[model samples]
Target: MTIWTAIFLLLGGVGGGLLSSIASMASLASYPVLLAVGIPPVYANVTNDAALIWTSIGSTISSTKELKGHWKETWFFTIFTVLGSIMGCILLLSFPSSVFEKAVPFFITFSGIMILVSGKHNTLNTEKQPTWLRIVYLGTLLIMGAYTGYFGAAGGVIVLVILTYITNEKFIVINAIKNVISGFANLVALIIFMFTSHIYWLQAIPLAIGMFIGGYIGPAILRRVPEKPVRIFIATLAFVQSAYFFYTAYLR
Candidate 1:
């Protein structure tokens, strides 16, 4: 409620947004800050998804240049993602957090490995993929979509890993594509949470603002940065996320 609290939340948003665009792991920055700022675990996660809508918007707006010809791919993936997100949201409300919390770290670890093996993903000819492979890709996206709706800590990273398998585009382009797809996952969660979950508007406002700013600049940063290091960076974050979640889920 204090001005300082608002300022702090804004700063958290900026950092979350930056990490989101650059690494697909905004929750690494935002989740803890929400907890630090005194939001309960229950509200923080939903609020994070709610504010993240701006991250999607900010990145998409800035991505106009990169997205010039990729609308078809972006929207196509969204269809599966939206359905999965709805399922995820329902599961979140219907199930225990421990269920996904225990599984997410593995998802993160798989994503890290996927990042390392990205070259192989790019070698596949998307156009020539068999119908079964195409189904697998969409199927994976649907499952990942549910993941995004469930906890969604690093949902973008999860999507980024699968995207490489199907799109074969440059990392920058993949980043842009994941932004819209994962953003919809969170956006869909927000829409559902608006009716069912508790969203702390006070923190959500500033967090949204910061993520928007960070998301806008992330794509441009990727455009200039080399892909090798960015891949390493994202993979590293994935491992760290996995380790942290494992500790929380099994150890602590």
Candidate 2:
């Protein structure tokens, strides 16, 4: 790519990573930049996946504090994340995302509202669950993981709501778990995509670099901020993401 294109991608990555680390939405900042640089749609999608790995890496590295006690659960659930991602990757190779894309706006908007209003309901610590309920929870995670493995536009927001509903962990802890596990899911998709020709590494590399920097910085900011403002910020981003995708999926 040209030096200017690299610079633009780098900047895009920074914004994407910052937003991703903070609110689980990166495409809002990075995906359009990939398309703007003239990469084909499928090419941009794969390249976007490649670059996003760095955001997970950067966020995980800096989020050690948030992830501390949650290590066991994170690793345990990541197996399902990997498995679901394999299915998603296989599906993506065979299917057009048009149908799923049509449903994304509603999911994003609903998840956003849930998080915003999730005050007392979300604050409750984990309660003992029955055996059947646990199975249902795992099944849900698998589905969400598959979604993350797919286009992953607002998958994080959906995950944020799901984790909150099931575990009811503190928001920061839930976010940390989401980041680490989602990284593994993306890793599975990356491995599958690596053999394909769609990934434009020239575009992905600079974006990854910028994303890593932003991801590394975001957790530190989150650590000091109060939860309410962060919740509002994420909810707002979700609404914006929902509207943009709505236009792309239907209004257009």
Clash count, one per candidate: 0, 0
Residue 112 deviation, candidate 1, in Å? 0.7
What are the per-residue Cα lDDT tens digits for candidate 1 across 45-151? 88888788888899999998888899999999999998999998899889976777888788889889888888444467788889999999899999888887876
- Residue pairs with colliding backbones in model 1 are none
Off by over 4 Å in 1: 120-122
Against the hidden reference, what TM-scores do the models get? Answer: 0.97, 0.94
Clash count, predicted structure 1:
0
Highest lDDT: which candidate? 1
The superposed Cα distance between candidate 2 and the true structure at residue 216, in angstroms, equals 0.5
What is the per-residue lDDT of model 2 for residues 1-252, given as tens digits with 9 covering 90 to 100? 789999999999999999988999888889999999998988888888899999999999998988888898889778877888888777777887775998999989998898898744634545666778777877877887888777677887777777776676678888888888888888888888899546888889999999999889889888899998999999999999899999989988
CA displacement after TM-score superposition, residue 153 of candidate 2 (Å):
1.7
Candidate 2's TM-score? 0.94
Clashing pairs in 2: none
